[model samples]
Every structure is written in structure tokens, then in C-alpha cells.
Target: MRKPRRGAVILLIVCLFFLPSCEAIDNDFSIWDKLFNPVWDGDFSSLNYKATYPENNVTSGGNMEAWLDIVGWFNMSRINGTDYIYGDPANQSITEYNAIDTLGWNDNMDWIKHELLYDVVNDTLIVQDNITMLWHHSEEKTTSEGHTYIQKTYYYSYLTVYDSEIIPKQYVYDGQNIEALITFYNNSINPKSVIFIPDKLGLYSIDYTYKNESVHEDLMTGYVENNSKGIEFVNFTYNSGWSDPGGNLSHIGVCAVVKGGNFTPDNLSIDIYTPYEQLNITNYNLSTCNLFKGERSMHILLFPILLIIFSPFLLIYFIYKRAGR
Candidate 1:
């Protein structure tokens, strides 16, 4: 009777201890929190403090100060807006926009489905109906020549809706306008290239290239003289050169044709180029920069860690059953 009573008390205590805690149930949404994380919450922008790109021109310098100062992102304005606006956590800027992150609101992984349904056909990353204008991601460098390159691909495809109808299924965005933004950081010493096409009945394609540093900006916008060939080929020597600490300031050029038409009534292919001269092209992957330094998303490994943490409960249950036998 004493032994049985002692076992009962121990079992009661164990049950109380093993029960889920309210604190665990109250876990905050990490995704939403990370989205609103500000680079400069106060008046850092108002102050006349202009930050220089990394000294070596490397994209990620593993500097805490740099990340702190240059980290936050502003709310994207409408397709046609007068000025940029900072995002408010309480309010959403783009109603239909979906973040490209791996997790969803329910913590269920559904990015793959979204990619196939939207990202595949749009020819652009559609985040909440609004196209991702500029994407800044880092990649690791392998060889000496191309150690690492920071890819900043801009998406400008607009679906013009007229009379409640989707006209011109999809339009090729102006590469020239997007190229101007690239020059703000890099120099144009290397050669550049571009390809463009106007849709006669459907969608047209646009492709352009710019170097790390260059002096001259190349404006090569070509029309599809022949649609059957897929794309018209244009080869030109790039004379423009820009300064760079990495030494080589050049980029390989390539383009593809999606549509074709004749002289006047048809559309014209338009593209331009200007590369960054002063900025250093560091060899590193942008996506995993934070991970390399021990900073990572806890959500990624949460499940596995939890499994290990709870495994002891199963062992205790088995031991209890054996003792009862």
C-alpha cells in the first residue's frame, strides 16, 4: 500500500510537469516580427548621415554596424506613386502581396505552390500582386574570376487592365529605366547588352546586361525583325569603363527574342546599361550571409529541436509501463 501511494504521488507530479505551459502556447509570430524590423526606427534618415558602401566594395562585410544602419526596408508605393513611404506594422501597404519567405501565416510551408501558380508564368516575382521591383540577394564565390556577385534583378512587368479585361497579357518592362538605378552603386567599365520585343497579340520579352564598372552607358534596344528566329542578335564593342577595387570591371552580354514585327506600326526594343565603378563586388551569397555568422531563423530548425526536447517523455512512459508489468 505504501509503495502504490508513493507511485501515485510521483505520477501526479509527473503529469503536472509534463502538461503544456501557457507560455509555450503564447509564442509570437516570428515572420511578422522580422518583416517589420526597422533598420533605423528614429530620425537616421533625417540626419545628413550618408553611409559609404563597404570599403572593399564587398556586399556583406560581416559588420554589425553596417547591418544596423543599412538594414531596414521602406513600404513599396503604388505602381505609380509620387514618393516612397515607410511601411507601418499596423497597416499593410500591398493588400494582395505575399511575402516570398518560406513560411506562411499558419506556419505551414506553401511557397512551392505559390511559385508554380504565380512566379512561373508572371516572369516576375509576384509578392502580393505587386511585382518585386528590386531583389538584393548574395551568392558565394567559387573561382577567382567570379568569386561572388550580388544579383539585384528588377521586375517591372505590369498587367494593364482596361474595361475589366486583361489587355496585353503581360508587358516587357523598360530595362533602361531599371538600369539607371544600378548605376547609383556600380561603375560601368565592362561591356553591356540587351534584348527587347513588342507583343503583337500576346506578351513580349526584355533582357539587358550591365557591368560592375563602366564609363560609357550603352543604349541597345532592338526590335524582333524575325519572330521565327525567337530573338534578333546584336553584338557591339563596349567602350565605356568605370573604376573598381576588384580590378576587372566587365560583364558578359546576352539576350533573347520573344516576339517579332516590321518597321513602323510595330513596337521598338529598348534597353540601356551603366555599371557600378566604386562599389566592391564581394564574393558571398546574400541569402545565407546572416546564417554564416550564427544568426538564423529559429523557425527553420524549430521542429527538429522540439522533437529532441520531447523525446524523454516517450522514454519515461515506456519505463513506467515496464515497472507496472
Candidate 2:
């Protein structure tokens, strides 16, 4: 066997210094999995919450009541109806009115400005509103005493979303009177599903399979489902400038809301799995392939540096072979 040249030995040493060892590669792959494929493996007891809005009358003959039970996850709707205008009491601002209009409440009713309050200690969410409505009734024909009679009724409404799980709950004080409380229960019934992509690049085309047979979209598809069964598998996407300090990606479970009447749960228990974990592509600046704050800069620079360092040795080997030929 011929001895290796001094230049070859030096190049080998350079490769050893720059290239990642097998152990290093394995360690790196594990880190990559942790960052991108974060497993949902922790106690989920914090997810259990019971929301109750007691029945009450803001005005005589007009009552409101609602309740929601959350077991695993929750999400709130984006303010799609109108921009919330602060200091606008009547909610007359075009944006504020539009927001109320989006809820599809009675047009005769006036929407007062709405606000949300959170109690950290109790883990309760409160929604307060000021609403007003005019109720009118008239008898067109003969009345009880052999004479035409007309009766007019007026209702003044005030609403609040007290001790709730969902955010920005809508209350109409429209006197519609809900007879039964709406209830939603998410019982842990199925194992959380995990998808493994062979490469990070494959994430763009990956499709997540949800255990809920009703789910039609992947975790990233951002679909909202509000059906007769109540809202489930809804993803809440916030508008620009809105930030969720809770660090949750869309409400990824089940929820139920009753406007003003009795709701009976046909299926009281559902298999509520933990929210799926995903690698957010927006965190990376795709144009530059640069991770935010240079977190992955070392990984990005490694391959290029290795290529540059080995080019001269490859060129030398080509030239020596040509000369020998």
C-alpha cells in the first residue's frame, strides 16, 4: 500500500476539524426534532375549566343565560365585524357597528361597546356590554272590553359574559330568553396523533391527520367549524396587530355557545386531544433562509464553509490525475 501524500494528510485533518462527526450529527438531529416536532407530553390538568353564565334579567320579561364546558383547548374569534373603537360608548363608530353586525343580532337592538376582562387568579374571563332595545306591541282589532286596545312594551338591556372560557363572548339582551344552558364537554378519549416528516423541507406538503373524524383540514389549514353540534376544531387566526400573549395557535379543540335558549347536549362527551404541535414556517425568513436572531446561523453557514475549504484539495487531485494520464 502506498503512503498518503502530506497534502492529503493535511486535507484530512482539515476535514476532521470542520466536518461533523457521526455523534454530532445524531445530537443535532435530536435537537432538530425537539425544536420542530415538539411532542405534547405534559400534564394537561390546567386545560379543564367550567364556564357558567347564570340566568338573569337585565329588563322585566327579558332574560339571558349561557354555559360552556372546556376540557382540553379553546380559541377566540377574530374581530372580523368591525374594529373596536375605544371611547365610543354607543358603538356608533363604523367599525364598532360593523363588528356588532357581524354577530347577526336583532337590528332593532342597539349594541353597546363591549370589553373583555380576565381574572388570572380564578382563571375566569368576563365580557361586559351595554345594550338597549325597544319592544312594541299593538292590538289591531277589537280588544277585551269591546274596544280597540294597544299595548307597548319597552326593554332596557345590559349584558355580561361572566366566568367564561371563550374570549369576546357575544351577548344580545334581546329578550329572546334561552330556556336551557348550552354545554360542551371534551373528554380525553384518543391518543394524540403525531406526524413524522423525513425531512424538514417536507413540512410544506405534509398533511396532518386528526383523530376527530369531523376534522377536514390539517393543523395549519386554519379552518373554523361552527355546526349544529356547536363549534369544534376551530382555529382562531388573529388579525394584524393583535397578539395572543398566551402563545396558543388557534383554538384547537371544542367549544359551545348558546345565545339565549336551552341547549341539550346530544353527545355530552367528545375525545378532546391536545393541540397539535407544528413548526411554524413564519418564524424563518424564507427569502434569506435565516432564522430569527441568528439562532440557526451556525447550521446555515456550516455546509458552505465546508465546501469552500475542500475545493482546493479537489482541484489539486484533478490536476495530479491529469498529469499522470
Candidate 3:
């Protein structure tokens, strides 16, 4: 009876300790599942672009062109007319004008360039380009109506990337918006093949041979530098230098064609995967959770055992009380 009572107390104490760990394991797995299975269905064009200008009214067709260049959208037309630039998308006419061109000019445009900064922080998967406008000159042009001063603002644009999904497999093109189809060849795991494409232009190539043993910190570092370097610590020493004749091939990931490389003009595909170090860390943590949760589950399963162990003592105690009464 004494042993039974002791066993029951021990089981309950063990279960109490295991419960919190079990709940924590469940929560961690939930978040891991969400993070691993990334979907690219969100928009990638809402990134912010900033530019400064004066208060005078002026034709900003060039500024609009620069902004479009920075955004790197599939722009068929230049700024105002039928003259096409960038990728030739088979007679697809993009005829959207800014607000200043439409409203103040002659009220014949769909979009407008107002004196507002483009904010795209909370926007979903939208890639925004950074724009800088320098007030060069303000000239007074004598038109047929009256003397109107036109503000000359020099616009400079920079391209940055922001994405909603981890691009495990996709096609990215160099100097074009249309991503070319490339395939991934996994040498180790079941001889799997995945098709990838490029999104921007740089030195695009394939690296199917070398498999790193750890999560390539350079990839994350490069991403941070290209997106939000000011808020984060980024080292771009390897990526920012001049390219050799054969082109720099130290990094392994999907990239644009303009950067540099042995671009074959064909599929320009590559195969990349999460490193074993990263996988090991992930699995170790998961295994720890599994063990902890398994102990909790064992405790849950042992509840009847606890009840059985204490049943005789409880029965004796009740009987003793009745006899005393």
C-alpha cells in the first residue's frame, strides 16, 4: 500500500513536468511546417520606392521611365509612346501613365506621380525598387499661355528584391522579365530533377556538383544586402569586386544575368538545396521535441497505471474512516 501510494505520486509529478514540454513541441512543429512549405502566390511588386522633387509642375516622363527601370516590371513601352524597351513580349502594349502626366498635363493618363513616398513594408511579396531624385534645375519656360517654371529633377533608381516565398525552383532571366526554364538535378536524393527559372538579369549558371555541408550564410547575407542592409549587418566584399574572364563562380544560387557568368543563352538553370548542417540542426531540434513529447505522451498513457496504484490505499483510507465513524 505504501509502495502503491509512492508510485502514484511519482507518476503524477512526472506528468506535470512533461505537459509543458509537450505543448511547446507541438507549437514549434506548427511553425516549422508553416515556414518550410512556402508558397509564392503573393504579389512581388509592392516594395517601396522613394524620390524627392520641387513644387513646380513639370513633365516627368524621364523620371517615370527611370522608376519603371528600377521596378523591373514587364514594361513593353518606354514612358509615353509606342517606342518599346526591355523585353519584347509579343505585341503586348503597356499604356499606363502617371498622375502628373494624366491630370496636370492634359488629364489623359491612368497613373500619377504625386509628392508622396511609396510605402510597401506590409505589402505581400511585392518587390520595390529604390529611387533617388536630385533637384538639378528649375527653369522658367515661356509657353504660349504664360511663363511657367518647370522643375528639372534628376531621378536615379536602384533595384532591390523582396519575396514572399523561398524560391526552391524557378526560372530567372538575364536583362529580361521573362524567366527562362532551367532544371535542377539532385545528385544524391533519388536522382531528382527540378526545373528553375531566373527573375532578373545577372551571371546565371548551374552548380550541380558541389554540395556544401552547411547552410550557406553567404546566400542569406547577399539577400539581406540586396534588400535591407541598413538595418542589418551585411558583408558584400566577395560580391562587389570586378569579375575575372571566366566570371566569379564562388556563390551558388539563382541570380540575374547582368551580374556576370558563363551564360549559355539556353536554359541557364541550377540545382541548390539546404545544406546538411542546416538539416542536421533542424532534425536534432525536432528529435529533441519528439523525445520530450514522447515522454509526455507516456505520462498521459500511464494515468490509468497511476489510478490503479493508488486505488487500494484510497479504498483502505475510506474504509478506515467508515470504521472510525
Candidate 4:
């Protein structure tokens, strides 16, 4: 009995020695999180920042961070807005918005569902967004529309520049706007107020009204994938219901603020050329990941296999030694 107990202890030690070094693999971390863990990326010190969307007091609530993997989402503001308000008679941009994080609220926008999915091949994130608007979230509705509001699928892809910053690679968001416009026009319903964001070089807002697609068609004809002047920031607003207290949780607009502040819209007070010149694009995926660094990674990954093979021999040796004693 004593011999068997001693052998058992040896086996446990062996098991401990052979476990995978990456804690994320075995733990609750999603495969997406495990694969794209920032630890493996080299020197993302640039993307690491304390504040995002400093304007409009975005930091007032918080930000949807995208260091390399779009760290966390904000309330889900879909686009940015400036003093430049668009639409006819009344503005249709997101006037009411939420700045809090998803995890902070127990709402319909589950953190798990909306979390950024990792695209291993390209090192990108597939952002999934589906939420109702704030005014429409209320149980009671004044609009002729029966359901009050509809949830539209808003998904986009973002690329990580490793140590640098993340950018929109696919430029699929323009199609999204078209879909939303079709819905509002088809249903003949007035949407929420919009804050026209004039951060681009030559931004022109369509004097749009409820159910008017022709006016906005020219504006949406082609989306700007690359803002040569560099994009100031982009915001997205989405609404989630407050399940607990039983009311609207308001709206959340996720802001992806550029860190270096190198790019400002065609501003009169700010020097666009100076800021644009200051912009720096770092080489992406230049170094090996943190844990899986060169041959060292191989050894770490293989450590367990070696230990398993040696454990039996180690146990036998220990038993022989104990008997001799």
C-alpha cells in the first residue's frame, strides 16, 4: 500500500510536468481568444491606450477597444456624428446613444454573441452586430408599424496590423447602410435622429426624409474604404432591452478611435497635412507570437509528450530505489 501511494504521487508530478503551457487552451477562453491572444503578438504598446473617442466625451461612458482583436465593444453606435446633421425636417442620425460596455449590461446584446471572431488566416476579426434602436426598444410604440422596430444584421471585418493598429479590410459596411435605408423606406417609418459625421475629406450629406431613398442613393453610391486623410474615428449605435428593470436600456455606440491622433478630418483649425505626415504604418506579423516563439515553442509544446513517455520509467526507478532502501 505504501509503495502504491508513492508511485501515485510520482505519476501526479509527471502529469503536472507535461501540461500545455498556454493556460488559454484548456481554460474557458474561446478558441478565437486563445488563437489571437495579444500576448503572442509583439509590441502592441502603440495600440494600448487609456482613452478613446475623447471628443463628444466618448470616454464619458467608455469605448469598444480594438487593440489587435477589438478588445471590447461599446454601446454599439454604428457610425460617427458631427455638428453636421443630415436628413430633411429632422436629423436621422443616432442622437440617443449608450457608451457603456456590453458586459456591464444584462441586455439582449450578449457579450458572447457580439464578441469579435478571430480570422486566423488573415489575423482579422469578424464583428457581429444585431440590436434594436432605442426609441423602438420601448414596449409601447407610437409608429403605425406594428412591431415598432426590426433588428438588422450588421457585420464587418477588421484587420490587425500586429504591433500597429486595426483597420477595415473588407469595406462591407456600405452595403449595410443600403439595407437599413431599404427597410425604413419600405416600411414608411421614420427612424431615429442622426448626427451627420463629416470627418472625411469631401463628405456631403443627403437632405433625406423618411422613406426617401433617392436622395441618399448618391451619398451611398460608393463607400470610402480608405480615408487618405486618415479616418478620425467611426461610431456605431445599437439598442438592447433592459431585461431586469423592464425598460429600454437606451442606445450604445461603439467608437473605434484612432490612437496616434495622426489623422484629422479636413479641419480649418487643425493641420491635416501635418497630422497625415505623422501617420506611421508598422509592419504586421513580423515576429513570432509570444508563447509560440521559434524552437522554444516546440519544446514547450512537446514537453508533455516527453514527460508522459518517461513517467513509467521514472516510477519504476523510484520503486527500485525505495526497495533498496
Candidate 5:
């Protein structure tokens, strides 16, 4: 009887802890089964951290390690036309005007310029990107397969994501007719705001803020200075000054084609990075970009592909060498 009573209490606590996490996903549960499956789905695009922390006051069990449900989905196109919603239209944070091609998102800084101040007392740093996305104010299921294990599963929208919007002034979800903040135009920009900061301590922070307003604003404290120093204790951001060499290697400076030699760093840094909000893959369809990411054995096949492309030349050279012999 004591064991049974203890079990009930644990179960209730577990439910309350995970309930907020559920809000980020949709109804389907099959995708979750793949979470632990040994088989590779060949879709790294489908491979994402969970749907991310729910924005509308929901919490990730007080540890928002999955990042936050930090992006919004807007209908950038019309039913009669193609997806003007560029790239994967999945984790985008900026907005663009359909009319004017040049002067874009009238107030774009709201999304990128934020200071996630480090807490000296708590030894933590917390900040948010695109708080207006919460206005998008945002369900679940399960299946039987011999319940040998209990894993928390999350699913994403096959719809609904693109089906909603809550951009301020420029757009309101479901035609809500409102204005707020953040408007950026230019190539579906989803800049990693945290990356822009020079003194960022993201690699070291260990906890997330539990109770408070979700709009994160506080800069990383002074720690590392590259070629220059930022204001004292100010968390400065730095978008790479180098121009894109024409493709999607966001951190072009780290790539072999660009600045590829000793991959070791002179300072404390992360090699690859996406926007903190990019982990919020709520409306993103994972199927669209697997081949591009070189997942699904695309990297495995690259050798065969190159071998075939140059096989004829190799054969000719081989025959010429044999004839010479």
C-alpha cells in the first residue's frame, strides 16, 4: 500500500512537469517513435531538438535547454502563387514586404538586438528573441507498442504552423488587426541573436530562468575580447562581417572552403551554431532539406557520385598507362 501511494505522487509530479512541453507539438505521435529508433531516417532536417519551449507562459520543466519556442510563422505568400516564404520557411524570425524589394522590415532590430544579461547572483543568463511571437498564442496523442519503456514524445505540425501568424503591425495572426514590435525584411532572415554577442557565455551557463516574464534581455558579461573590447559588462553581439560566399554556410569563417585550416580556436567558442530560436521547429516540415544537409547517407553517397563522375577519365588514364607499359 505504501509503494502504491508513493507511485501516485511521483506520477502527478511528472505530468505537471511535462505538460508545458506538450503545447509545442501537434497530434501525430509516430514521429516520436523514431526518436529512439536505431535506424537512420536519412533526414537530419527532420532531426531537430524537441519543439522547443512553448512561448505562451509554458515552461520546460524549469530548464529550457531545448531553447525556446522562439520563432513565428507567417503566411508570406498567397494561395494563387508559389511559396514566397523562401528557404525552409520553418524557423524564420524576420519579416519581408511583398511590394518593395529594397527597403525591408521597417523595424527589424526587435528580433536581433537583445541583451541577455548574466545574473551575478544566480550565476545564470537569460534572454528572449521575438517576444511578439507569443501572440501566435498557441495538443497530443500516443500508441501501443508493448510499453516496455516510457519516453516523453513530442510531435510537430504537418499543418497549423504555416496555418498561423501573429506578427505585429505588418501582420496579425488570423487577421487579428493589431500592432506590436519587430519587423524585418530581407531573405527570410533568422539571425542567431546570441551569436552576435561577443562576450556570450552560452557554452558555460547551466540553468534556465523558471518564473518571470519570458522576454529575455540581458547581455553576456565581459569575458573574451577578440580583436577588440566591448563596453564593460555589456553583452555585445557580432554578426560576421564577411560577406556570404554565395551559399548557406552561415558561419563561413569556420568552414574549410573559407577559413579552413587549424580548426582549433584561440578563444573559447562553439564551432557550429544556429539561432537559439532556430531549435523551435514548430511549423517546420523536416522533409524539405535532408538532401541538402547531407544526411540520409547523402554524405555516404558523395564518394560514389564523385567516383562515377571521374570514373571515365580514370579509366582512360589507366588504359594509357597500361599501353605505355
Candidate 6:
């Protein structure tokens, strides 16, 4: 075999250096967490807003208009055990208003189910509601069809008193919001093992065990031992029940949080399965330690710097190849 040329040897060395750096680029930055599991500052209180209505009188018999008026009236009125009262001028049972509400209701839904829970130990208040809504659209003059869609939206909200300050918050539309709240104290708890017991007649069960005895805030340090008998692990999401905000867990995943600060997931594993079959577990590992330590932006900037450093080497390799050819 002929000995390799000097240019070839240099090219090989450049590659050895370049490939590792490219791989290290990912490790150097917590790109997964930044993209998927973004760091939440745990300031959910901003989501809290008192229900309000327009000062102008609602005038119309259209379904959308009628439904809005009913909702506005319901908010303005006092709720009295299946009945609503708005200054004597309006007094109606929830059932009476359900008919008009259906006009704008999605999926032919006629009810709004609400659940509320209070945790004395944690000093937390949780409210969950399943509301069916009629999504409306205007008819296009060009198209022959009108547009309307019905949808059921689930909302999860929580309120807590920490350090004598009221912290009220709600989850964003994405599914991760509820999980953030439940595992808000994971880092602080720092449990060696977490066993999620399935509720009686429940849907799923989750268990987590840590391999390394020593805890490293920077590394993912555990394994998920899913020993569920019948319940299949779904997405990490909030319980829809109002009476138990943390109950009826659907999505099972892990989370990390800084006490009195923000919440971010280090890893999330989703298990998909049928009612009576083997489980399929999909894992998502998110690196967020750098984000918390304020190194994220610096790491992102390093990518361009690496390219700049290697650009000359890459150009030389191409030029040498052209001369040899």
C-alpha cells in the first residue's frame, strides 16, 4: 500500500478535530431544553384574570350573540346551586340557559363542567374546567360553505400562597403546563425514587428510580421503571377533574424546579399503549442546567465561533484535493 500524502494526513486530522467538535456542539449547549422544554419562571400568577364583560348591551338573537350574552350574564350573576341571578332582571336556572349556549357550543356541547380543589398542606388552590365551545367563522363570498367548528378545551389553573404572597396561575394551551405545577418541587424534593400509585379505576401508573446515589444538578441521573399493571402511560398532562387538580394524572413525566424560582424538565418519557398490550416508551431528555445557570446564550454563540475556526481548515482541504486531482 502506498503511504498517504501529507495533505491527506492533514485532512484526516482536521476531520478528527471537526467531527468531535460538531458532536460536542450539542453537548456544549442545552439545545433540547431550549427548544422543547423551555424554562418557565413559575410566575403563573400572571395568567389569572377576573372574568369580565363588555359595558355595551348585547343585542341580537343570533347564536353567537346569544351565547356570548348568556356567558356574560352568567359571569355577572351570582351562581346559586344550578341557578343564576343577575339583579332580579335576569333569573334563570343553568338548565334554562343551556339551550341558547348550545348555539355556539362545539360538538353540540351544552355544559361547562368545573372542578375545584384546595391543598391545605401545600397551600395551593386548583381549578379545572372542561368547556365546550363553538368556534365560528365568516362565510367567504367565493366559497359556498360556511365555517364553524366545535371543540372541547380543558383548562387547568392553580393558586398558592408562598412567602405570604398569592401566586395564582394557569397553564398555557400546551400539555406541559400541568406537569410543571405538580413537579414544581422535584429538585427540592430530590427523591431517590418516586412511585406514582394508580387511583382506583385509574388510567395509568408511573414510577421513577435513581441510579446514581450522588445527585448532580447538571446531569440526568435516573431511570424510569414503568411497572404499571394495566394503566398505560399517556402524555404528561393535568387532571381534568376540578375536585382533584393533581388527581386523575394522564401524562406521566419528570420535572425539575428551583425553589422560589422557575420550573423546567430535565427529561420527559411518554409511554403509549393499548388497553391490554405491551407498553411503548418514548423518552425525551432535555438539558436545562445551563439555562438556569445563565450559560445558554453563551453556548449558542459558540456554534458560530467553531465554524469560523474550522472554515480555513475546510477550505485548505478542498484546495488540496483540487490540486491532487
Which candidate number maximizes lDDT?
2
Candidate 1 lDDT over 1-325, as tens digits, reads 4466888999999997666543311132123222332222222123222222212211121110111111112221111111122333212111111223322232332222111122222322222222222222333445677566544332222221111111111212333223111111111221212232222111111222223222222232111111111211111112222222232222323222112111111122223321101121122111111221223434333678898998999899999999999
TM-score of each: 0.11, 0.20, 0.16, 0.15, 0.14, 0.16
lDDT of 5 by residue, 1-325 (tens): 4466888999998887555433212122123222322332222233332223233433221111112332332222211111123223333332211111111232111111212221112321223322111001011224476445434333211101111233222211231121111111111122211112222222211111112211122221111111111111111222123333333123322221212112111211222112121121112111112232322333433678999999999999999999998
Residue pairs in clash, model 6? 44-169, 45-168, 106-133, 106-150, 115-242, 116-242, 235-251, 236-251
Better of 2 and 3 by lDDT: 2
TM-score of 2: 0.20
Clashes of each: 33, 6, 34, 26, 15, 8
lDDT, model 5? 0.25
The best candidate by TM-score is: 2
lDDT of 3 by residue, 1-325 (tens): 3466888999998887555433212222223233333322112222222222212222334333322212222221111111222322211111111222212332222332323223323322222333333323344477788867665543332222222211111122223233334333222211222223333112212232212211122221011111221111111111222223122223234322222222232323233221111111111000111221322234333569999999999999999999998
Q: Model 1 segments beyond 4 Å from truth?
A: 1-247, 253-325
Question: How much lDDT does each candidate structure score?
Answer: 0.25, 0.29, 0.28, 0.26, 0.25, 0.27
lDDT of 2 by residue, 166-273 (tens): 223331222122122222222122111111211221111122222221221222112233222242223222211211212111123321221121222331212211
lDDT for model 4, please.
Answer: 0.26
Per-residue C-alpha lDDT of model 4 across residues 249-291, encoded as one tens digit per residue: 1111211111121222221011111101211112111111134
Instruction: Write one digit per residue (lDDT tens) for candidate 6, span 187-293.
Output: 32221212222221212222221221111111111111111121111112122221111212222233221233242233323232111222323333223232313
The 10 consecutive residues of candidate 5 with the worst lDDT sum are 225-234
Judge candidate 1 at residue 150 and give its lDDT.
Answer: 43
CA error at residue 258 for candidate 5, angstroms: 27
